[model samples]
Target chain A: MAFGIGSGIFFAHMPFLKLNGIPGTTYRVMPGLISKRLTNRLGINFQAESFGNNRQKGMDELDRVLDRGFPVGMLTSVYYLPYLPKAFRFHFNAHNLLIYGKQNGEYLVSDPVLDFTTTISPKDLERARFPKGVLAPNGRMYYPVSVPEKVDFNPAIKKAIRWSGFENIMTPPFLPFFGSRAINYMANKVAKYPTAMDERKAILFLGNIVRMQEEIGTGGAGFRFIYAAFLQQAAKRLDNPELSLLSKEMTGIGDQWRDFAFSAGRICKGRQAGNEDFKSIANLLMDIGDKESAFFHKLRKVKM
Target chain B: MKANEVPQDDSGVIGGKFTGLKYATDENGNYVEVQSIGWDAEITVLSQAWDEVNEQAKEALEKVKAGQWSTLAYHSTKCMMNEAMLSEYMDMSKAKVKEHLYNPAAFAALPAATKEKYAEVLNIDLNELLRAE
Candidate 1:
């Protein structure tokens, strides 16, 4: 029933997997929160192998099973290659995915990275090698294998593999979920609303403004320093005694504000200085601001 | 539909002026689309710069030149992805932009010098670019 529920949802959502595709499953050896969510949805058992120990022991256990002619499922390597007995070296990353049923003297393997369903001959499996640094200090790998029957539970082994309480196989990664697509479609629909567009434009403008500030800290340092020096000179220009003392003070403050504003403008200008997207977006914002100001002026005139 | 009507389909939205201008037809008959202008342009610029620096570095094999190239590329990419103009144009989430740029497949086609040039133009580090898994 558990498998049925998971499979039903998985199969329903991702019909693309059935189009000239092989049936397969996915599992995470060391399940993180995201992996746990996947497990719940897919009904896959979370078999947690330790990065520190037990991985070698698990590999050994797998080898024993393979020797007994039990169909092997893909091994999920959380960290480092499990120490499989020499006979199983052929399966290292080659028949990396084990098949439950053989059609043409080859096991169908599902590769996550390759995004293709591959059929590997036993000879090819023999020559397959683990990735470089697979045996190193902190390397991690995950494999999916075919099993003769549901994985038998040795209490300790089950405990080691059961990172999460859930236990069911998951659909392969290539499967598409209709629910997600639907949600995305709806979101794109909502984005077309004028209010949403305006909000997006505003947020984009604000984000650009913030980014411009950060750029000045990096590549715009020269311009910033020059702008600062210019402000200092402007401040010095307010040294006229002929003007009222308060006027002179006001002039100094004005000069300081001018410098600050100029520095800010320089930083903003420097951000999209050469980038066309920035130029366009900046122009759009300016146009929007101008239109808004004009609208306000027209409203005031009408009120008068 | 009226000109101001909200676009209900991909074609309507995609054909809109803002989005339409983002793509262009190249001489090779491929549609070259600008995913993110500021960020891509910055990368192009940094990549160009790195090409020069790398040519000199290869002759001298100077670590400093290499380091400068790396820093330039890294800073630019980071700035581009994190900053507003480039980030907004990204097809994926903002967080994923950095990862996408770092992906090996993205640079697989470029030669070492060309890749370095691209990094310089983008204001990123070559080592960092290569290291992106």
Candidate 2:
């Protein structure tokens, strides 16, 4: 999995940063890191550019690159992308997509999560590229500059897996809002939300979490599940039985995350039956945190 | 998840407007791309979010009907924008945007060109900018 090889699975529950008035949780590394880390690990020559205040110059450069027949990745805001579903468009500035070709004043877009390719008008694309505030894209784009003819995969996969295993398993004690710790941290915080915050805000906060978890681009699965898929593929090539077993366990953990989303969704919809309240969901999160804590540690010890 | 096990439960929230790709195990136990027509959990959560947004817009529309807030307030809330964002887009200070949203006297004193700017940014005509229909 390019995702796991890039250490994409993470958990961060941020209360200090507010998004749309909801305290948000981030499930992956920052927007650009996965590709950056993955390319670096694979020794691929990658080139990226940011236009800063020079957007027209950025567009010209983008045109120049596309003229050379390279599809470039761009950081964009979802809110101005008219091709997205009405339900999916928000002021989110970290959405990434590919611009492959231009035709008749529209750019051909291969948005990562969508089932089909779409097109965006130049003006709309410009609006999506420059949403103000909070991790603004600033007309950023990246493309691979060159590719190596030969490479070894087994060692690279093992190194990446081990590195990511430690990354998820070893967040420090003081910054409790990070890594697997945040899963447990949120488990504790969910209990206080009902009493600490107003009813609507509490519900919206949980909804925001669910949005991050099941966001359409994640292929309707948690990163753990995606990582598990990666592991299964890797195990076959590596002939590693231990990884196969852990992959199954990771799938189970992913199921638990879906259960969390289900229970939290019920609460947000005001359909929580007798057992679907905050306490039960908090317990569910604790159970998930424990499983993940054990899983990552074991993953770190895998013989590779 | 296995290909067959992927949820087909429609939450009545997209109604076929959107489809996403999922990674699921194929019959041979290899991973493959499986298109999903929205999952139950995601639909439930996103519906709650949209409900809140639309509900707030409705309340703002009511407030506009009652002459409590200017139509700028109604348009901004309906578009899921806050004063900070609107201010940035309008190139006005946040306090000035607040006045445009709330203070009837300040809004009424706006010149035609200023109103045109708001109308353009909000993607509404001059008539729609005057009041919420």
The DockQ leader among the candidates is 2
User: What are the runs in model 2 whose C-alpha is more than 4 Å off?
Assistant: A271-276, B26-30
C-alpha local distance difference test of each model? 0.30, 0.83
Best by lDDT: 2
lDDT, candidate 2, B17-131, per-residue tens: 5677777777876677777787777887888888889999999988888877888898888878888878877889999999989876688799999999988777679898887
- Model 1 residue A230 CA deviation (Å) reads 58
Candidate 1 CA-lDDT value: 0.30
What is the per-residue lDDT of model 1 for residues A1-304, given as tens digits with 9 covering 90 to 100? 1211122111021223221121111111221333334444444544433233334544455444445555444433211122222211211121234434344766555543223355655433322322211221111223233223453322222222222222212223343332212212222322332343453332233232223222211112112222222222322343422222322232232233223233333433344332343334444333322332332232223210
- Give the local distance difference test score of model 2: 0.83
Listed in order, each prediction's TM-score against the native is 0.22, 0.94
* Candidate whose TM-score is highest: 2
Q: Please compute the TM-score of chain B alone for each predicted structure, in the order given.
A: 0.24, 0.90
